[model samples]
Target: MGHGTNLLRRGPRTAVAAVAVGALATAGLTLGPATAARAAISCEVTYTGYQWGSGSGGFTASIAVKNTGDPVTGWTLTFTFPGSQRLTQGWSAQWTQTGARVTATSPAWGGPVGAGSSFFLGFNGTWTGSNPPPTDFAINGVPCTVNQVPNPSPSATPVTTPSATPSPPPLRIVISPKSIVVPEGGTAGVQVTLSQRPPGNVIVGTGRVAGDTDLTASAPVTFTPENWDVPQTITVTAAQDGDATDGSATFDSRSSQITGSSAVLWTAVERDDDIVP
Candidate 1:
């Protein structure tokens, strides 16, 4: 699904360049009334903004269409999504998704998007949890007044009990300077490692530490997994001055062996799979 094509050909005005390429090659898809009197000459469409792709599991967006109305012959776009973010595969156009709605259409070589021109279409999804992305959206069916960019919150607060007593498995932690390229106020020294299996004291908590916007640390240090299975290391010393972006460091576990941190600031309520990554 790599359909990202952009073609804009404007050479009209020589007596309406052969009636605008024969009215954009039979522009008929049932818009009757002779395409509404040829769209009353003066089209307009715009929506420029969107492109995302990340993983802890799933996310993909890529929308961006423009026309500013007036030279169109075809086009239609729609958007929607809130909870179960669906919509999986899409490209140059022609797509549909029910539940958390989505729609796109623009083939026939993108009919006629003159008057300024711009195009893009993308889709791919899966996000059954952590909701936040619906400040109201729309396009083609109008609305999309702009808004959709918010995903960060999962520092710590995930551990619920149901009963049956069987919990202990989730500590993949890995830090070894994974990122601390200091300089904005310089000062770095991180070394956190822990796989799984061993238990009996392993606490390291501060919540968030991705770029250390002005780094500063003193939390994290308590290990003992050198025989109960193997995998352990602890070293902390962070200190940045401010602003540069890209910081991370979080840990919490003093027994019960269950840690977390891959890039989820805060938002978890139940998840205990036996740890092993």
Candidate 2:
């Protein structure tokens, strides 16, 4: 009986030690064969496009991104156009195009995507010659499985249909070179343009919305119906400061004349001139 009791006490100690070892392994002690790593990012994407007119035509592309891996707080979708596709407008995301590559980043109101969930983004673009859809896509820098949807076949017999009234494009302020770095005590310029022609002459104002007070913007600029599409330069000047740390500011373009027009924000960073002590 005494020997049995001793064995039972030793059994508890062994079990406790085993549990301790398991805890350490769970904490990444690597006691055994390496644990399989979970992929940080994985996705599946669907792409579809619709075009109207010919030669220089306009297209609208829709993309659905399904998360197959972990949850993501934010996402950036990237692709390369096979043809000469140019982005004109986008929704649900911020879109930019450079050469053949295109990028779409999550907007402020966009929400996160959980594992096994999906989100949608799209844009309006212009193309010439051929309007071939992109074959590849990546989300958050990881390659995604792409599923391309074929364009619908035209009807053999033409049928007359009533045309609905076309809606006007949303008013927007377009700023070129949305970001810049202003040298301390120097100036940098950014061009501002209107997304669409205004009803009449529009006066756009530039002002600092937030951040360092040392950064200043030029006076208001006017955009007329004749030159609404043309870019108007807005000069940003950084005041010299004694601090050695780089300062940053947010500048916004606004207009009181254009109702429902959204303001555009741009960032400016002041280069530090003073050396750290």
Candidate 3:
């Protein structure tokens, strides 16, 4: 029967070129750019081309597929473009070439990538003449490390103990109530706790939370954590000072390198020496 219909159409076109790699994430941020530390699961690829004539042109390739090990579930990558790039179309997964060897797999929702996480596969190609870029890449078959964006190594024995970059996760500014009780001149407000939202202004440091004498704040405190999303108030006002015998004062909100937590405002002297006839 015509050789079994050409072996069932070449066995599903060689299993659709055979290539698959599901989503992977974890590896602690850092994906698609600026990366280092080899082994454990690595792969990188980036290609871009544009011509639009004579044989047509238009290319875009992005394959990261990293992991560092463990937590796979599904993945497969194989590359070979050297030149004549011709992928046609692609989205998140399912892609297959034939001549220049290209195959990516992962469909039906496509997902899975943890253990230092990494999973990126973009594609869009259609070339005819020249469209270099795609020297090497692999996932299921190993091989993949691309991502070298660091130059300055004359190598004359230069190693001045400077190769440790990974420190940015310690900024907590919490300043809520802590203690408040006002009813003399009346007025109490102290709130400051921004989780994440600050690319500019952050100057907080009021006064009066020191030696108890009835609150009185609103000093150089100007925290604009971009909008903080919510909870952003700092107002403490209480001053009666006739003394019927109820006294308490404290106002202290300090923040040097993103760390503010100190609030206390209590005052209840009542009437302020008066007789509301």
Candidate 4:
């Protein structure tokens, strides 16, 4: 009886040992892949200089994405602008604007971003109001701090008194081909040439024959008119034109004049005209 009892105890102990070993093996199998996955994925993005366009009067910032982690099938970038700077255009990714915040996502390309591989995206928009770029930015939800770029100093000082020799107006403006014809509800392209370069903070106003219209650019103070109702002569004016420090005079206008379907005759008013035309 004693021997039988001892044999039964030994059998159960052996069974328990086997079960413990099996559980450890299963745990090792489960953890190994997870560790490997983490090692394989990379998440680093590099920022290059922006490629500015002529519309919306703002700069387009470019960035490169390098996958350092396990192959990334997808990712997202979120950033905020300091002050009133806003994002108006983007490519290679979908963008959403909320207040001063902007977020971009990679949805078009789903193929794995293999380890060490990279991709690129850019954002374009108007600065509208005066403000600086935000210091904080993010990649794939990771926090990043931007290096602040120094602001350029103002070049021209206000003229205290009219010189005996009056200086020519800071900017000379000309409308190219002087005219255009576009279908009603369509857009007309107008080219403006400037005798002088424009200031960094320069603002250009659009004048049309009818209806309210707004123009924008990706480069500074340049734009294309979008909404038109009828045909009419349009005059565009530049304000706060800059001098040689920023660039040379003789800058071309990206957005100066636009006409509608119905031509409205515009005559320049002269000092001699008793009645303004």
Tell me, by lDDT, which candidate is best: 2
Tens-digit lDDT track of model 3 for 198-226: 66666666666355465566665555756
lDDT of 4: 0.49
Q: How far is 189's C-alpha from truth in model 1 (Å)?
A: 72
Error of 1 at 228 (Å): 43
How does residue 97 of candidate 1 score in lDDT?
81
Candidate 1: Cα lDDT at 192: 56
Write down the TM-score for model 3.
0.20
The candidate with the higher TM-score, 1 or 2, is 2
Instruction: Give the lowest summed-lDDT range of ten residues in model 1.
Output: 264-273
For residues 194-234, could you state the per-residue lDDT of candidate 2 as single tens digits?
98999898899988999999999999999999999999899
How many steric clashes between backbone atoms does each model show?
28, 0, 23, 25
Question: Residue 168 of candidate 1: its Cα lDDT?
Answer: 61
Residue 83 of model 1 has an lDDT of 70
lDDT of 1 at 15: 49
- Candidate 3 worst ten-residue window by lDDT: 148-157
- Per-residue accuracy of model 1 over 1-277 as CA lDDT, tens digit each: 2332222223334547788767866565445555645543332233332323333235566666555555666766766676766667788888888777777777768767776576677766666544345444444565544533444323223446587977766665555544343333344455555656445655544344343333344455556666433433332334432333444444332333453443323211111122234
Off by over 4 Å in 1: 1-55, 60-73, 78-89, 92-105, 109-122, 125-131, 144-161, 165-277
Question: After superposition, which runs of candidate 3 have C-alpha atoms over 4 Å from their true positions?
Answer: 1-162, 166-185, 195-210, 213-229, 232-248, 252-277
